[model samples]
Structures are given as C-alpha cells and as structure tokens.
Target: MKPKCISKLKITGTKRILQISLPSRKCKSIRVSPLESRLNTGCANSPKNSSSPLRNEQNNQKFISRYIARVLAKPEFQNKKRPIKTAATHRRTNSDGSKEPLSARNNKLSGGKSSCKNSDSDEKTIKKGLGIPNPDIQKTICRELSKKKLYKTNDTDEIIREKLIEAITLSFKTTNSAPNTSIDFYKLGKQIGNGAFGKVSLAQNRLTGHKVAIKIIDKSFIKDERTRRKIFQEVFIMKKLNHRNIIRLLEVFESNKNVMIVLEYAGGGDLLQIIKARGRLTEDECRGIFYQLIEAVKACHNMGIIHRDIKLDNILLTSDYTDIKLCDFGVSRFAKAGEKVDEQCGTPAYLAPEIIADLGYEPFYVDIWSMGVLLYAMLSASVPFKAKNLHDLHKLILRGKYDVPEYFSAEASDLLNKMLNPVPHMRISLEDMKLHAWYNGFVPENILDLSFNVTRQNEILSKMMSYGFPRDYVIQSLNLKDVNHASATYSLLDLESSYNYT
Candidate 1:
C-alpha cells in the first residue's frame, strides 16, 4: 500500500485468488496445505524436526502444502466418487396406471399451505437422515414407498390409485399407461373405487352428459404377451355378461397404447365399507346379504365366467343396499361351455386348498372357497385365515385350518366348515348351499328376488350391524351418532323373520 501494491490472480479450477505483490512487483501466492500441516505437527518428535519454533512452523506450512496437492492429485478416488440415483427422486406409476409427479400432495410451512417443490437440498436431507441398509425387505418397502405414499387421505382418482398401487406394488408390478386416442373418450373425475387392474374413476362421457366409471390401465405393466391377450379375453367375457348382480360395461375404447373400459357407476360404495362402518349382521340380515352374494356368484358360473376375484370389496351396493352388484372382472377366466379351469389366480386369503395345491381344481370351487371367507367375515367381521405371510396363509388354507370364535353361532361355524373344506370334491356346491339349514326357513325358492328388494335389504344391513357387532367396536368403527338408530334398519314389530340370525 506504501507504493501502490500490484496483485496477481492465481486460478484453481474456476476460482481465482489474488496473490500479494512485493515492492519489486513479484507476486507471492500464500497457499496452505490443510493435510500436510496436520502430518508435520503430529511428527514434531522426529530427529530431523529439531529447529526453532518459528523455523519449524515455516517448514511445516511448506510440507503441508505439498501433502494436500499430492492427495488431491489422486485419480482413483476422484473417479470412484460418482453421483448416486435415489428412489425418492424418481417418478413412479400409480396403481391406476397413471404417472404422478414425484411430490407429496400436501405441503405446509408454518401453517401456510403451498405447493412445495422437491429440491436437491431435500434429497441431501433424506440421504443424511435415512441411512437405509441395503436389505431385501428394506429395498422392497422403499420400492413401494417410492411409487406413492403408503397412506393418503385424498379420494382424488389419481391419488387413490397411487395409494392402492403403493399398497399392492410389492405383490404386483402395475403398469402406467392409458389407451391413447384422438377422441375424448371420457373425462375422468374423482376416484370411485379400486379394483385388481387399477382403479375406477368417475369419468363423464364428453359427447353426452352421462357419467360412467372409466377403468384406467397402464399398458407397460401388461408384462407378457399372454397376459396382454388375457386382458382382451377379460374384456370379451365382460361384454357377454349381463345381469342385475353384475356391473355392466357400457362401451370400450382403445388407442395404440391403452384400453379405456367404460362401466356403469355404483353410487353407493362396496359391502366391505358398509360392514366396516357398521360391524356385524343379524341372522336375517346376514342371510339376505349372503343370499345376494351367492346368487351373484351363481350367475357368474352360469355365464361361464369364473369370477377369480370375489371378495367383500367386489360386491357393491346400489345407492340403496337393495341392489347389489358384483364387479371386477380383471381376474375372471371364461371356461368352455361346461369346462372348468384350474388356474392359480384369485387372492391368497380366499384361495381354495385345491387351487393352492395346484391339484387341477374347478374354477367354481375357488369361488365357493372365497364365499366361505366372505361369509366368515360377515358373521365375525374378520377372515377365516389370518397369517403373517402368504406362505403361512397358503399352509393354513391347504390344511383347512380356521378357528371360528366362540362368539359365532354353531350354525355359522357348521356352514363355514362345510364350504371351507380343503378338498375340492368335499366342498359344498353352490346349489347345495342354497338349501343349507340356515336358509331352510326362508320362503319362496327365489330368495334372491325377495332379498334384493329395498326394504328387506336395509333391514338386514341394520340388524347385522346392530346384533352381530360387539357394541363398542361397532360404535368406534362407524363413527355412529346413535348406536341403536345406526343398527335400526326398520321397525322390529313389522320385521320379517328373514333377518333374525340366531
């Protein structure tokens, strides 16, 4: 500064530092060796290090500078440090075959709601916090979580499929593309419900104001060519099927990439949600619902469509509980005129022992097995076999091991045991089921027509939830205002004996 100092710039990578200038204008760069300084300081007791403190400090600085440069110059370590790809950062397909942007639906900062952007900084935080070990279970769980959040409160069509897809992704790898088309087939709205393939969205027909549930499918997940062909086969089967108990397919549209299936919308939700909200059913109410369920299954078998997937979720109520519809033909297989299939498909929990054993059992037998589980769940609010893993579940199913709680009546136990027999030949036929002791008292051979009526159906739902459910569990599950009124389907004085379970 005494004589205007001239500084020279030294460059490292893209960064430049100014070097101090001497009186002669000779610039001297003060470079520090972070590693070398530590090594020299630690080696102070060496014989060659005998020097004055100031001299030693000056020599140590020079040594440290060289050490840092030597370490920095190593190519192997530098080459090994590649950027990592994280699961959370990737875009994944939802259950309904839609690719959702990778971000949480809800974002709030200090109670202020806003769309939060996913950033590298957020990735850094995740890397630091979640030191997830590379184990198979952890990897599987992560893989599922990456596609969609485990649980979501949103009922939006896209988000619902996302959640359901995430739930089942571990077991099933769903595809993520819809049929591409020029025509506006339907405008998808909020999610109506979930099915085996993906989800059903309440879509409006663009041309007409008529509303329909559009089933979305991601083409990428079709996997094998046979599976893809099976999808078309299912569509063909659904086309021919027509009945009151079955949800009808209105139209079919396809683009190069996806198939858009249009189906009638059931305003009321599924039987599972109703039973979950209510709890248990009375004998008459149980009989009523059971009769409808059996009739629906019978109808499918009659049409040569073996409904591979038949559970509480597949049976939906028509606004009023009177009209019940069996849906989700995704897993259904059509047998020849009188032929029965032996495919290992249907849900594990509901799988008949013969199907699990691969013993070439009839498709209708699997339906009966699932019905048994359905009946058990209706009577007791739980499935017959509850195991930790699918293998154990199959073992229990094959062993024909299921415990009917003391709370269940002996008649119910007898019925469940009859239908749940592991041997396909031993299992009771649907026709024989119609004549069971529990249903012996009901009038008119056409129990289905009588049960399908609006007044009788509601009475059954109310009584089943009221009498069958444990009071405390029923109230908690349903969020009921009055437990009594909630269970009250109709006046007991004028009530038909068709609903009395005991």
Candidate 2:
C-alpha cells in the first residue's frame, strides 16, 4: 500500500524542533485503516528486519539532512545565521474558537501576515519554520529548490515556497575561488591550433551555447614557481584589458595537472598565416591593418602595458579578415613611465637592436622597434634583419643593416627608418607614428577615440557584460559619456572608472 502524504510540517520554539501533522481519518479518500494511519503518522514500527513505510520516509529526511550538512560545510556559508523559524502553530482558532484543520493552518502560513519586518528576516523565519539543521545547510537546500525553478508565494505547497526563498538569497554569495568541479560546463571540440605553451581547441559553453577558444596549458611545462606566477599574472592582466583589437579572456579554469584559459575564438587565424597565403599585401591593405595594430599598441601603452612580443603571429584576424586582435601576452609586462626592462625576450626576427645589445632597454622603445619589423614584414613578406645564426642576426641588427625594397612607397620607408633606428632614444614614439604622412589620409582621425568608435564602445560593453553588468546598464553607461571630449589618450581603466563601472 502507498504511504499517506504529509499534510503539514512546522518548526516550533527557540530550539526549532520539527512538528508534523498527519492526515485525519475523517478526511475524504482514506485509503488505509484508522489504526494503520495512526501507526504511520506516529513513528516507524519496531521491527528488527522488516521494512516499514514510515521508516523509509524517515531515512529520506535523514539523507536530505546529510546532503545539506555537506553543502553547509563550504567556507562561504560558515558565519551565516541558522535558519529562523516562523512562530506558526499547528492549528488556528476560528471566530467561534473552533480549531481549524491542517489545510487551514498551511493556508495561514502561506498567505497570512508575516511576523518579520523585511524579506531577509522573513527568509530566516521560513528557514527556521522548515527546521533546517543550520544556516549553511538551509542555504544549500534552498539553492537546490531554486535550480528546480520553484516559486515561493505562487506555489501551493508551503514547504516548497520556503525552500525557494532560501535558495534565491543563498545564490547571491558568488565566490571566485578556484572551481573544484569537472569541466563539464564546456563541450570541447576538435583541436584548432597548438603552440609551445598549450593547445587551442574550440569549445562551447553548455549554459550559454556560445563558442570560444580554450587554451589548455600543461602544468609540467611551467618548470618553476616564477613561470607559474607569470601564467597567473597573464590571466590577471588579460582580465583587466578590454579592447576591440585585443583578444578577450572569457574565463580561466585550473586543475592540478593543467590550466585552461577560455578566449575569444578568432576564426580567420593569425596574420602570419594570412601573409603566408597571400605572399604580400598591397600598400593600402597594409595601411589599414597597420593602422589597427598601432591603435592596439597605443591602447596597451595607455594602460601601462607593454606587449614585449609583437610579431605577425601574435596578431590574429577576425573571421571576416577586416580587423586584427593583438594577443599572446605570455611575455608582456606592466611598465611605468620611464621604467626599463632588461629581459631579452621576443621572437628573434622581431627583437629590437637595444634588446640584442644585452643592455637594459626601455620596453616601449623595444615595442616600437618590433612594430617597425612587423610593418616591414607585412609589406615585403620577409623580416628586415634576417641572418644565418643568432650571432649573425645580432651583428646585422646592431649595425642597423636593412635595405628597404624599392617597390615600397617613400613614405613607408621613411616611417620604417625612424622606427628601426638603432638608438632607442631616436625611435619614433607612437604619437608621432600616428601623425606620420603615410597615415595622415589613410587612417581615420578618431580611430583611437574609445567613446566615438563603435568598435571600442562594443568592446567596453562586452567587457562590462563579462563583469556581470546588465547589457542595458552598460549601454546606458556608455551613452552617458561625451563623445567629442573622450580621447584615446585616456587609459581603458581611466575611461571605465570615469563611468563608475567598478
């Protein structure tokens, strides 16, 4: 025979003991005998081996309590108060002083005036009324109810409604602790690319159904604590940068054996692949791509960041090939004005003469020199300072021995010469490069304006969304800025802070 359903349950007194109300035999559709009903309602039968229905129900409750206890043990819920119990009685006396049934008592609990003043206190009272073992356990139980999409006041069941409120509030305590769960949230696809650091694969978010690139790095390859710290620093820096011409870091997941970084999927591949396919680009085409690259570099500098390794391979193209994103900050560094970096990092073909000199060099100057080499490669399909060995390459770079192809425009050669000057102090600054005669008519005047440029506005919006801001709210914030006065001179942090987004 099926067990009779519970009619009502409530918590009573300061200790918050659970009180249950069993169905009355006088009610309609009584399936069991009055003795059976009374036996089932009171307690389980005392049998050594026999299974009783009431015993099963008690076991289920205990199972739930154990699960809740496990969830409560999480550090986030440690200091939370125990679920408050409502001062609800088993029965209410009517106008004639007659005690109402379990159904009427449930109605009173569900729809009657709440004794608490605020929603927080009401939630506490409901949790107490449910007789949850502790606050943490109560929070976990509520989250489960919320995931099931339970409605508090709308649900006819009082027990379910109380559980829903508890869950909705518990979800507000979001944590940034390294996730201990499996990577089941992402549906990994076929491998798309690979590098010395990691392999990139296409993956889809199981929740949002959005496609992204996942870079999975092997922890064993990191070798030292310094390298591990750099990996974390890269993640931290990328999270702060929000630019249209820079790849977005969507999320990071780390495990004992590997680290996974989710990024914007650039389907058109890197500029190197495109260059290899097309051999060389026309001057106009080169001008457009070069303009975007400079703008990206300018943005990075404004934020006090230096992309130590700036090469054709580090620049990725969007699917349509109309724009490029500067990525791979593995060797990048944060620099203050006038600070010098001594590291001899970056690809050999693109390393600046100052970097090859083994002397401390300003990172910004090294970046400028690298951009010159990149520009040369884009127009000529070959690196300017090529040699048979590192020794020969260093000698050639030190001598500043690079011949500009005659086919290149005079304006391009002039800018390249200024940028590739062997003396770091003589290298062209980013501000000067923007106003060069070559880019005067080719690039837009407001290309670097974050507020006026639609691409930049969209990039800022995308970043704010990643930070959990609503889309409408981000749009409203962006629209409030004065477009004409906002310049690329402002750092991303400065612009974002101006709008009070943090």
**TM-score of each model, paired residue for residue:** 0.51, 0.56
Whole-model lDDT, candidate 2?
A: 0.51
Local accuracy of candidate 2 as per-residue lDDT tens digits, 320-418 = 454567787765656655555444456566666655554456556677788888888878877787665655665666666798899999999988977
Q: Write the per-residue lDDT of candidate 1 for residues 1-502, one digit (tens) a residue.
A: 0011112234332111112121342212111112111110000001111232322223243543454344345453234322211111111111111111111122235553322222211433323222212335433443434444344344554555343333333332232211112223245688754433455577664323345577766566565544454455555556556565677655554444555666666556665555555565455556666776677777777765577556666676554344557776655655533234334454445666655443345546567778887787667666677666655665666667788789877777877876776544445666666677767665423322223355654444454333233334323323421212112212121123332322
* Highest lDDT model number: 2
* CA lDDT scores, all candidates in order: 0.47, 0.51
User: Quick one: best TM-score, which candidate?
Assistant: 2
Local lDDT at 355 for model 2: 58
